[model samples]
Structure formats: C-alpha cells, structure tokens
Target: MLLAMALTLWSSIFLIIKVGYCYVNLSRKKGTVASQSSTHEGAFLASRSIDGNKGQTYRECSHTALGHSIAWFQVDLGGEYSLESVKIYYRNDANWCPYRFRQFYLDVSNGSAGSTTTLTSQRKRCYKDNTTALATPPSVIDISCKETARYVIVETTYNAQEAIYLNLSGPVLEICEIEVYGCSVGRYGESCSRCHGCSTCDIISGACQCGVSFFGPNCSNACSVYCKGNLCNNVTGSCTNGCEIGYYKDKCKWTCNPGCKNGCNRNSGSCDNGCIDGKYGIECYDVCSVGCISNCERMTGTCMCKKGWQGEKCRECSPTFYGPSCEEECSPHCYNGTCYVNNGSCIDGCTRDYTGDKCTQGLYETSPEDHGTAIGAAVGASIFVVIAVVVGVVTLRLRRKRDDSSKAQKDERKESRIKYEKETTYVNRQDHSLPGKDHSLPDSHVHLGKRPANLKTQEIGLYEIMDSGNGENKTYENDVIAKTVAPVTNTSNDASEENGNVYLVINESQLNSSHYDELHVQN
Candidate 1:
C-alpha cells in the first residue's frame, strides 16, 4: 500500500510539468498575435513606421479585414510618380509563419484614395535564402510610370502555406520595410536621354565613349580619322599624314609601284627621267627597235611600210617572185610556155622554125649533104630531065602533063573539100528514107566546092625545097602518059538530067593510069 501511494505522488508531479509547458506555448502565441496586430496599423505608408526585426518593416492599410482568407492592401500616391524603385522586406522565419511567401503583385492606380484607377500591374518573387544568411531582402524594383496614376497596391500572390511544413514544422515569412523614390523625368538608373546637346550616357553613367577608331560626343568620326599608325585624322575624314614615296592614296596603304622592282614614280610610269628609247612596255622593259624598217618611233619602235613592200626591213619583193636570191625573172615563151631564166625548156614544146634559148630563132638553110637521100633523089631527077629532053617537044609535053596533073589534083582536092564539108557542117539531117538514122554535119561542110589550087607543095613532095635560084633551066621529064580524050558534055536532055542529079562522079582508072608513069619515074 505504501509503494502504491509513492507511485501516485510521482504521476501528479509529471502532470503538473505538462500543464506548465502548455501555458508557456499559449503565451508565446498570444505575443506573436499582438505584435502582428500592432504592426498592421501603419502598413499603408511607403516607409516603415515600426521595425520588428532586422530588415523587417510594417505597411499601413485602410481596411483591417479584406474579405476571404486571402487579403489585399493598396495605397495611393497622387499623380504619376516617377518611381525610382521599390524595396521589399520579406518575413522568412519558420517559427512565425507557415512558409515563406515567394511571389507578390504590384498594381498602380490613378488617385490618392476614393475612385482610384489602376494603370498597370506586375508580379515578382523573392530570392531563396539559407538558415545562417542575413535576411536582407531585395531593395530595388523598376517601374515605367509612362501613364499618370495615384494608387499602388501590393498583393500577396503566394503565402507560406501548410505544404512547406512536412520536414521543417513551422511557417516562414517576414517583412521589415518598403521604400519608394521619385526618379528624374525620362531617366532611370544610370541611363539618361540626351539633353541640351549632351550625348546619351551609358548605363553606368560614364562619359559617352566612342568606338576604337572614332571619337566625338556622337561617335561621328570615320575609322580612318585620328588613327596613329597609318591613321586618319579625327577632325577630318582623311589620313593624318600623306602617303610616303612609292605609296599613295588614303593612309599610304596602296603600293603605287606594281611590277617595278627597282622602284617607280608614284605619279608617272617613266624610268630614270623618261623611258629609254625603244623601250616602251608597262615598266619600259621591252626593246622595240630591232626589226623595224620605217616610221619607227624612238620610244616604241614599230615598222610602217608602203604597199607591196614587205620583210623584216622591206628589202624583198612582195611574193610576186619566189627564189632564194629574188633575182629570177618571169617566164616568157610562145603559146603559154614557161621558161626559167636558168633553164630553157618550154612548158609544152618549142614553136615551129624556132630554136635556141626560149625558142626565139627562125629556120636556117641546111647543106645538101646534110639533107636526106630522099631529097638528093629529087634533085637528081631534075638534073636528069635536062639531059633527056629536047627543048620544043619537052616543053609541049611538060605543058600537057601539067594540065593533066592539075585536073587530077583538082579532083583529089575536090574530094578532100567534100570530106572537110561533111566533117565541119553540123547539120541535123533526118534520113527519113532510111529510118532510125540521123546525120549531123559540121558547119564548115555547109559549102560544097572545089578545093583551092594552092595546095601545100611541101606535103606533096615529102621534103621542102631549100632554094630554086639557078640560071640553068632545070626540069623533070614528062613521065606521066597522056591520052587524047574528048571533053564530056551532056548533049541529050535525059543525059543532062542524070548528070545534074549526080553529087560527084570521077573516073578512077583514068586518074591512076595517067599518074602511073610519074610514080615509076620518082621510084
């Protein structure tokens, strides 16, 4: 019974300790509630009225309770304020709030209080934090107040809710202060607009700087201007110094002496004082006087000659004659013959009775001994005739024989004339009597007549007589036999008709018999 009473006493002590712990926790929560209630009084103002902890500030509000579990607070600053920036102190202690509030909304209005108008809105978030790091919240937020506005509202989009307490077992949210500043018109941060001829500066507010190769407030200078090494002047848009010799143009950058290794004038293309005579190429390096003949220029020797003159020096004929020495004359021979000055042969053959170089000479008499034996026999016959014949009888017989021979020769000549006429006349005679045959006679055969008595004696004798100038009379015996034949005449009318119809009629037997004795004598 005593041990049981001791145990009961211990249990009572433990129950008292538990009750004391609960009372302390309740007091702590009440204190926190009081602090929050007091801080909400001046939360409408931009600047904090109370500082609960480091970087912790309070903002005033017009209404204590704003409908629903979530609430919104708004403050109106009359007119369009050039908002330099905004600052926020976020409450982030796990022991005070459920979780850290991460996101917030900033809204702008037109008036100070009643009938406020909203101009714009923006959402923002706080940076993450560590346990030991100081809770210095972001101090600045930029806003373009292009439109006029009076009221600005800060609304909580996210809160430290129960989701963040699974591991850390408490809420984490805080705010120490909020600050706002008015910036210059049309200016924000370190950047500003150009004003009163002043150039627009950079974001850092340093002097308006230009590009590496340019200068001036607006960077209007060219790259070549103000350049030091082969540089251009800053004031002007040209090179600072002119180009050196053998160089020209802007900054002396281009080489004026191309293809000239020795060197060249930057302005002219002459060598030494002027180009040497006969040298006139790009660098005056070519020799042009060697092969020129006339009108050769001293600077650039080129030949000009008259028509039909050609050669390196115009010293030869213009292709009219072809020879190594150009001295051979053109050929001149009869009948289209071509005879070289060095050799004498006609292209075809020498002309008749012409001999010697180029066949220009006439015929000359040959000795009797030089004449053939046939010619000798002809001479011998004439001599023998003188011995055998008496003057009177021989003359009469010779005259008769001549008449017969002339008639025989006339008949032969007539036959030849008829043959020539048949060959020359180009008559297209149709032989209708003999069908399927046509005769074409030459034009020369159109006239049928006796041959001329001037028959060539050279052809008849087989040899030409050299000369016939002897005082002694020489003749050949009348070897041709003669017969006293009556002349033929057509007395009867029927006979005349028959004779007229015949084209030609000759007695061959009579002509042969009459010429037989002469043939034998000549043989």
Candidate 2:
C-alpha cells in the first residue's frame, strides 16, 4: 500500500513539471562571439560557433589563425549569471585532426569578452581536457562549471613539436558550437524563481543563502526588531545567541516586564535575577508601596517600610500616630488640645478636673479625704526612708573609726618590735670585749638555738633580759630560756660602778605573765 502511495505522489509531482522550463542556454545567439584570428576569408567566423548549430562544415564552425602562439574563442553572455554547466561541439569532418583541440581549457570571468587583461588576469579556469589522445575524440563534451561570470572563453596553447609532427603552421581552434546553461543573477531552479534577499542559492532546490538581517527558506523574512544584532537562525528564525536587554523568548518578540532589573529569561520571560527596587511578582510587574525603603520580596510583595509607616504594603501610619490607621484623636482634657502623637499623652499639665499624664483620668473618681490620706502616706514613707539612710551612714562611719584605732595600736607594736631587733646586736665569743673582765666564754658557752616553734614573731621578742637575772648582766637568744632568769640586786661598790651592764633588748608587753613564774621556778 505504501509503495502505491509513493508512486501516486511521484506521478503528481511529475505532472507539474512544466515543459520548456529548463535552465536557458546563455550562449545561444544571445552573446557576441570572438576568436584570436579568423580563417578561410571569414567563412568560419567566431559567431558561427554560437549560432545554435552543431554542423561540422566550414560554414557552421569557428576557425582561428594557424600561426598564433595560443588560440582562444570567447563569448560575452551580455550579463553576469550563476553558471551551472557548459557544452562544446568540436569540429568532426572527413579530414579531422584531433590535435586542433588538444589540451584545451575553459575559463569563466566577469571581465570583457576578448580583452587581453581580462582573459589573463580576471579569468578562472573551470574545465580542462588533457586526457584526449591523437585519435578521434568525442564529438560533444559537457562540463560542470557552476561559476558566476559574464564571459566564457576556450583557450589552448601551441605546441611546436606537435605542430611540426601534424604538418600544421601553429595551434588553431575550431568549435562547431558552444552552449552555456545557467540562471540569471539572484535567481535559481529550472524555472528561474527569485531568491529574495539572497546573493546565492542552490540551483536545484531554490534554497537561498541569506545574509544578515534575513532568514527563512527563500530569505524573504526579516529578523525580529528585538534581536540583538538583527540576526537569527536561518531555518527557524530564532535568535540563537541571546536577545537584547529587556527582551525574551526565542524570536525576542515578547517584551520583558518594566520591573525586571537587567533582563528576563529567554525561555519563560520571567525575571531570572529578580526585580528592581519597589517592584515584585513573578515577572516583576507588581509595584511595591511608595513608603518602601528598598526592594520588596520578588514573589510575595513584602517590603521593609520607612519611618512613619507600617504594614506589609506600608499603607498604614505607624504607632506614632496613636493608632494603626492614625485616625484616633488625642485626649480632650489635654492642655491646649495638644498631646504626644506616639502615646496620645499631654505635653504639658492636664486641665482643671483631669489627672494623669494623658489627662484622661477624672478628679471625681476619688474623694478629698482619700486624696489627703494618700498624701500623708507618701510623706510618711519619705521620712522613713530618710531616717534609714541616716542611720546607715552613721553606722558605716563608726565601723571605720574602730578599724582605724585598732590599726594604730598594731602599727605602734610593730615599730617597737623592729626597734628591739635592731638594738639586740649579735656577737660571738671572739668579738666580746670588756675591761678587767673575761667577757668571752668557751666556744660552747655562746651557743645559739632555734626559737620555740609555737611562738609567733609578731607576738613575742626573740631575745629578752630581766632584772631577776644575776647582777652581772646576761643575754639569752631563746624566748623560753630568757624567762628562767632569777632576780638579783647589784652591790653598791666602786668596782661594780666602774663596769657597765649589757642587757638583752626585749618587748616586755609581748610576754605572757602567767607562764613566767612557772618558767622562773623551773630554771
């Protein structure tokens, strides 16, 4: 079934193929033909080659001079065209010489037909015949040129050796007929349809190769105005790279919402980077409150309000206006009808019968007796507070005085102790001296021992002397042994008066009297 359908479809397409609609032969008596030099008294002029005749006789062929270094035959197609193919019918006569058209080449150019500079400098070689041998070659040859030009030329170089071998004067060109098939500029296809806004196109399909600012099969459609460079995909008409700022979508046809910051999404037209300040919503089209200090939440329209306003949209006045809507009146009893906007409180004192900061409390709410009692209570509380404060200050001063007095006593005792320590000079037996007396004792006699472990340095003196010791004075370094001395009286005599008594320095007040008699009796 599919094969039958395909055959029917192809039959319909062939039925529409118009007759006589092939690409035109641009060289068929339509262009002026010329050659390097004519021969046989103009019998074989170059015009005969393009006269739509393929006869091999001298009347129908084009012949050039025999003595030229190179021979060329050319035709001017009158206008430039995109050439598709070319055909050449060589002369085949009873006295045929294949060497006459040996090693020939065809060129196409936009230059003039026979100008030396145009032929040599501006021509592009499109076809060459190097494979034909000395035997009779094909009578007709077709070449696929596919070039764009206004002139077509066939050229061959003269070979001196081949010319001598063939018994010819020089190289010569003979062509019975030549045909060039192509479409006019800006047109293609067998029917020569126009390629709108295209400089080149496929000759068979009519598909155009469009330039900038154009697209589509025939390149007739223009790119969108919002496109970045007026450029787009040639087939789909979509801007492939990106759209201009504030534009979105494939063809950049949709305008972005004004609230979008930089641009929008190319596929969805949503603000990808969010909205500008004071705008919200998916496309950033919703406006935020005028009182908003900065941008709002893009999808929610929530914003931070400025001073004096509140609420999500910042449409309501703040609490400074007495209420959320800012419509509540101040207290009527306020002084001069004026009050603070924040709390609706009187700026000055309240009027006659009113009381309290806001002037809203009435004096009739309480009796005079009750008011007086309240005042008396307040005054009594004040007096009690003052008495308590005075008592606390006096107690603090008495404590400080007692502490100072105790400190003075301790300072005096410390000074006495330090003085005693300085007065009690230490001496060994070797340093001891006295006049007419042996003050030095044996090495063991001057022995010193550690003070009692229970004694505190600040509470007791290390060395002490007492009047209870013998009349000859003595010093003891240990506190316990010093208390063991017994009382003695000095005799009033001349020898005793001549000697001085050495006493050990002591702080008598630091000693415990209760333990003294026990120590004395024990010693």
Candidate 3:
C-alpha cells in the first residue's frame, strides 16, 4: 500500500486539484521481485516489503550469495508504460536500519523477450558509502525514468574499500515499494483507453490534447482526407491554409472537371473562366450528332444544321437544295437548274406545267415547257426595278426644288452692294436694257438696279469694284470670284458687299476685330 499512496500523491500533481482523480499503483497486485540470490521465501516474497514486517522476514530479503561482488532487486510493473518517474523506498525505515547497500543504481526494461540490456542510467550510484557506509539507503529516493518499460530494478556493487569498511561484508539489495508514474502516449483514462487523434489525452478522463496533422475527439483521425496535402484544424476541421489543385469547396469536397474554364466556378458553371460551357445538362455530356451546326441542348439533341443539310439532326435536304448532300438540281424546264428544296420553286422560277418539290410533279411531261414562264418573270422583275428607280429620282428632284424655294425667300437679302468704279464690261450679254432708258446704267451691256431675273442661267462679269467714292479703278490682290457674275444695286446706308447667294467672301483685315466677337453665335 506504500506504493499506492505514492501513486495517489504523484497523480495529484497532474489531475487531482482540477479533477479530484487518482491513479493506480503499477507495482501492487501482479508485481513480484527477484534478486541475484535467494533467502527464505526468496526475492519473490520481498515484493510486499513495504516497511519491515509485512515482507517474508527481516534478513529474508533479497540478499546476494556471500562473496558475490554485486546484487540486484528487480520488480515487474506488470504492463508497459511511458514510465515518467520511479521512487524506491528503503525496506527498514525504523531506528537502526539494516540492508543498506554502500551505493546503488536503478534501471528499467520494456521488451517481453527478457533481455537484460534494456535498462538505462547504468550503475547510477545512490547514497555512496565510500567515505563511510550509509546508515541506511535513503528512506525515499527519486529516479527520473525517460524510458518506456514494464520492469524496474535497484542494483548495487560492493568494492574492496566499501567491503573492508563494512568489516568485509558482501553486497545485498532490498526495497520497500517501487512507485511508477505516467501512462503510454495516446492512451488515457482509468483503464488507459486509446484516443481518436495523435495526442496525449487526460489519463483519468480520456480527453485528448492533439498533436501535428491530427483531429477528432481523440486526435486519431487524419485531416488530409479532404484537405489533400494540408492539415485541417483539430477543432474546426477547416483547410484554412489552402487546398490542392483540381479540388475546391469549403472543405475541398468538389473536384474540377476539364469542361470548366481554368477549372473555376463562374455563374454556377455557365460562362467565363468560372463556367463550363455546353448544353448545360444531360446533352452536355454527349457528343453532338452528325450534320449539326451546333451541339444539341438538354434533351432535344437537335442542331442548327449547315446550309445544304436539314431536319432536326441536320442530316436531310434543306428547303432550297435537293438530292443527297443537298445538291440543287432543278428540272431542265426550271431556269438556272435551281429550285426550292421544300417545294422545288425554281431559283430562276419554274416552267408552266412544272410545280412541285424538286419540280418532280408536273402536268404532261417536264419538257422544257417552263422556260418561257421563267424568262418572262425574270425580265418583268428587271423592268419593274428600272421603273421604280426612275420614279424615285423624279420624286427626289421635286422635293429638293420645294426646299430650295423656301430657302431663297429667307436669304434673298443676305447679299450686300458694292458700287462699280466706272462703266464696266459684262459677259453672257442679254440686252438687260431698262424701259425708261435706252441703255442699262453707264455701260450698255451691264444690267443694274433691277437684277437679271435668271442669273443661274446667265454669265456676267465685272472689271473691278470700289468703296463708295469717285476714285480711279483699282484692282484687289485676291481673285474673289472668277466664274459668272452679275451687277447689283444697294440703297442701304451702311457699307455692304454684293455677292452670289452661294459664295460669301469676308476680308478679316478690313472688318474691325470686335465685329468677330459679336458674330460668334450659334448659326
């Protein structure tokens, strides 16, 4: 029971204050002790040597054969564990203790093959009695056990100096109780149940503290199932870092197919880089039928066939074309050897008695009888087109004339006047003589005052013009108008220019700059 109390106290450091739970003593029930030699009931009965009396007897401990240089006391802990630490209490804890080795060391073993070298901390001397033999090996000694093992031992050596100091006595190993702590990794609870994840769980409660690349209640499940190369969070189970290529979703549950553009979800897989184009559903998986212009959609599987092809599958002849491969072969009576694929309506039109799909149905025999009707129709259509064009042109000219008349009324006064220097010569000479005078102005051929009625049909000329002054005839550097010209009259007080309604010449150098500023308005 000394071992039980030790385990209860040790476990309290790890669980009790928070959980009020205790651990079991690994060396109590099934454990037994053995030594290098036997005494009384042998080392096996020494397993109960908690204090001094409970063991077989006083000197009946695990004593070595006399003259032997070394002795050992080993205890089987029954089951393998990630041995945390061990505490070996001395057998005789009374006033004058017996069976204290000069010095000793502890070791452990894990394998079931019973190999001896499975121990560590070789010969760790405890309470060396070199200067003077120890009164009694430490009542309690602590040993750090970083190894995994199911057996523990207390072994010692007897040297000459220590033997002589003890009056030439041989070595003997004894133990009261051996206390071991800690359970194996991944195993926890009172019965040491295994957890679900790669973690160390609460030994008493069977709770898990997961480690790298693991998840679930006991940290035994792999998180890479959906995450591919990544490890999901132990608690959240999300591949927060990222997912593998060709796999997508919150948990990377969906796989990307080649039909998807750049393998992404565009408009629920409709268009763009995120979309996978096709008929969208069942028809999308199947190949388009032969003679199809475009693939079938959904369940119809029909297509927009090519020019020569027809029907839902686009395999038969079209309305205008005939024969296999839709070669348009009209009857000889059908002009241009072309007819409608649907009813054989000739491209150049059908003959008199021939009328049907491909022109196969006809009155009498289709013997070139339809050519006369075909030629007459084509000529009639051409004649109608010519007449329509002539009518269109005449109508357009009349509309233009009406528009021009209105504009003339609005702009007849847009012209101004310039007085001639002297009697000037004019061309396209009409008499233009005034009724009140024998001659027109100073020159006979020159028309003035009242203007010529049809200036568009007449040509006239002027040598030079000048400002309102009796000055010599002077020419301007610029040739303002070279074509037909007509004499004009102006009675306005302000200086004005006389010009054809179609031509207006402005002299920027002559007009005051301010005039331009005021003139810049919307036309």
Candidate 4:
C-alpha cells in the first residue's frame, strides 16, 4: 500500500512537469481567423472560431454559407510558428449541422497571409476525417500537424458520388473553436527551446535545421571561410558547396598547389586540367629540370633534354660521354679521360703521341710506303731547283753580252770624236797660215757662220747623220720636232757657195767647246 502511494506521488509530480512545458494555443485569440462566405455575415463571422471561447452556442461558433461547393476556414498566426497539433470543437447545438464537419481536412501553409489564394495553393494537408457512413460525427477532434507555417486552414468539399449516402448537396463548415498548439519560429519541443543559428527545429526533438551559413547539431558552428557560399553539411561541418578559388578539400581548408592553373582537385590537390609554365607532377609543385627543352611530363618530371644534356632529369652528363643525347664517347686520346660535353674535344690536352684539336692523331705511325713517297717528292723538288738555277744563269749571260756590245759602240764613237778634234785643230792652224790674218784669234773663240746662240752644235750633227741614213728630204728648221733638235739658222744658205751642200765645220776652239767634235757634210 505504501509503495502504491509512493508511485502515485511520483506520477503526480511528472504530470505537473509535463503541464509546465511552454507551448501555447496559437489559434486562440492570438491569430486573425477568416473563412469563405459566411452564412450570416454579421451574426456568424469567422472571428468567432478563435475568440478564446469553447462555447457550443450559435453565437460562439463560425458558420459558412449552406451552398458552398467547397468551404474553407483559416487562421493567421500573426507570424510564422511551428505547428504541433490542432484541437477543433465542432458545433453541437440543436444538432443543426452534425455531418457538415465530417468530411473535412486540416492543412498548414507557409504562403502569404494577405491573400488566401496563396494559402490555398501552397497548403500542405495534415489530416482528413474518415468517419463511417451514417455515423454520428464527434463533437471534438484532435489532429497532430507537425509543420512550420503562418496559416492553419480547414477545408471541406462536396462530392456528388457520395451524396446518396452522405445526404448532402454541398459542404457547409462550422466550428466552435480552434486551438492550435505550437512554439514560435526557431523554437521547438514542449519546452519551446531556442534553436541557435538555424531557421527552424524539429517539433518533438528540438533538432536544429541549419541555415545556409551554419552547421553542426545545434547549427551553432559557421561554415569554412573558403566555402563558396558558406554552405556546409550540418553533421560533419564539411563544405557542401565548392570552395573559393585557390582552395580545395572537403572542408575547403587546404590551399591549391601554387603551380596549378585555374585551381586544383578538391580531394587530392592535383592539377586536373594542366599545370602552369615550367611546372610538372600531379600537384604541379615540382619544377622542370633546367636543361629541359620545354616543360617536363606532368606526372614524371622527365625532361626532354636540350643539346648536350642527358638523363631523366637532364641533370648530369654521362661518364665518358658527350654531344647530342650524350651518345658519342669522348676521345680515347684525351688526357685523364676528360673532354667537352658538347664536342668530345680534349679538356686537358692529349695523351702522348697524340695531336690535333680532338687528340686523335698519331705522332709516329708512318709506313714504309709513306716514306718512299716522301723521298720521291724530295727528289722531284731538287730537280726543279737545279733547272731553275740553270735557266737563271743563262739569262744573266745574255744580259751581260748585250751590255758589252753597247759599250764597244760607245768607245768607237769616242775614238772618232778624238780624231775629228785633231783634224779641226789642223784646219784651224792652216787658217792661221793664210795671208792677211794679222789679228790672232783667242784659243777659246769658236764661230759658226751667222748661227743663232740657241742652236746646239751636237744636235745639228745628229740631225745631219740621221737624215743621211734615211735618205729622206729633211731640212734643218728652226722648229725642233719631238724626236730631234735642229739648227736655229740656215746653215746650207751660209754654205751656198759650196753648191747647196750643208756642212758643219769645226775650228780648234769649236772642237774644245762643242760636245760633238766630228765634221759632217750633208747633201
């Protein structure tokens, strides 16, 4: 008996706690009630339904016109709220309309409260009455409509097919009171707890339904800063939308590889499309080798080497290798096995007995046949030298013979000049012997008969000699031609008594003064 009493006391305490929870009657005088055409506009207005009265009298209930094809009654909760349940009290006074509210449905809408058209169009049906045929409809009904809305509506429609059993031409809806129980928006549960950083919550559990910028159980956490639209998964806190530029990963917490173009993969940070210039590898983080002709392969970083470069990364020249692809071997003659990578030339000069730029020539490897060829060339060169010497000697002898002949002719002319001088002296002495030559002429005094002082005696002699050999009728004129000098005066006229013969007579003094000592007679 004591245990039963204790159990009863505990139950009593639990009931008091349940009643203490914070839900309110959202449709009781807290909202504006409305309906389709009223039966009597002033007497049975829609406002009577939510007047905070549970009275079943005609003046306390809301009534619709009798002939309404589809009748509707609704309440505006003034603001959005989470609808938990709806308790409706139907008209029971005088049994005037027992079956009127039988075939009805309850719905909630989040549409515009200013126009009932939006409320009807966007309504979500919550409950429908399924009463038996000819059965008495209940005076009061309770419906669980766990929905978030601003408008709570009840609708009833007439069906011609069911008119035979329902005995109704159309639907006429009347209600004594409507008690909607729920919490305000963003709050939920019997306690009406607030849901932080969210739009709404579950009515029974108070679990938050996060907004675009929030995540986590209570929607208290913000999305990652790199998330595209601040949208993320509520449970995991990962970005649901993509990340911003240069960012990646599920939560958009990691940055893209620096060498990537556009961006990188969200899962692995790999550059999918391609890498930037000179970059390689999946993440585009590795650089191409310096010796690469262009960029390396995206996955391997293998370089297409430039000239004289080799290996996977083109980082080094192979041992004893040089030139294109490093395929050509260095010269064996190179000292210390070292050579230029580009041309395989010796870098430290040649080994012993080797010569030339690449150190490939041998110093003492001549054959007997080569020696014989060298001897033959020497013999031929000697013969050519001897021939040249002999020809030069013969040419020198001919030149000396011509010079001696010219000297002999000059000596003969000199002897003839001496002889002419002696003859002239004799003639001059004979002249002195002539009678009546009292005045003795000076030894230096020489005369040509009336000749101009400008006339050269040697030139006159040459002209006379040349003219005699040619047998050309050339006369001594005052004008000298380019080839010879002439007598300035007419010597032939002076000697006209000698029968038109031209004569150059030289006295002893003339022979001494004149360069030409020979006497000439020209006819």
C-alpha RMSD of candidate 4: 21.4
lDDT per residue as tens, model 4, 282-381 = 7888888777889888788887787646789886676567765676777889898778877888889999998767888788866555889999999999
Task: Estimate TM-scores for all models.
Answer: 0.23, 0.36, 0.29, 0.36
Model 2: lDDT to the true structure: 0.67
Q: Model 3, poorest ten-residue lDDT window?
A: 514-523
Ranking of models by lDDT: 4, 2, 3, 1
For 1-523, candidate 2 gives per-residue lDDT tens digits of: 9999999778646644542337877876345555544464556788888876678765578888776677778878887887888888888777665556767788988875456442365888888777555544466888888767888888777454556766666767888898888898778877778866567765656667566777788788888988887888766779866899999988999999988889999999999998888888988888887667786778987778877667987766654445544455657787876666666777777899999888878888775658898899999999999998897788677757965875667656555544443344322324343334445432211112233333232222244343222448754445553422211222325333433323232333433221221111111
Query: Model 3, 1-523: lDDT tens per residue?
Result: 9999999778656654464333444554454333343443344344444332333234534444445556666666666654455666654644435434445666666532234532333322222333244454455666655444666666666543544566756666555456655566666654556755445654545545455567667676666664756677665556655556555665665665555445444213222343243433321344444557665554555778877677776767754567655755446767666676655567776667766544556777544678788788999999999998997788678757855774565333222111121123121123343333354332222222333334443332222332223356544322322234433333334424453222112222222111111111011
Our model 3 lands, by Cα RMSD against the true structure, at 29.5
Error of 1 at 475 (Å): 63
lDDT of 1 at 494: 44
Model 1 segments beyond 4 Å from truth?
A: 1-70, 92-94, 97-100, 109-149, 163-176, 183-494, 497-523
lDDT of each: 0.37, 0.67, 0.49, 0.68
Which model is ahead, 3 or 4, in terms of lDDT? 4
TM-score of 4: 0.36
Who is ahead in lDDT, 1 or 3? 3
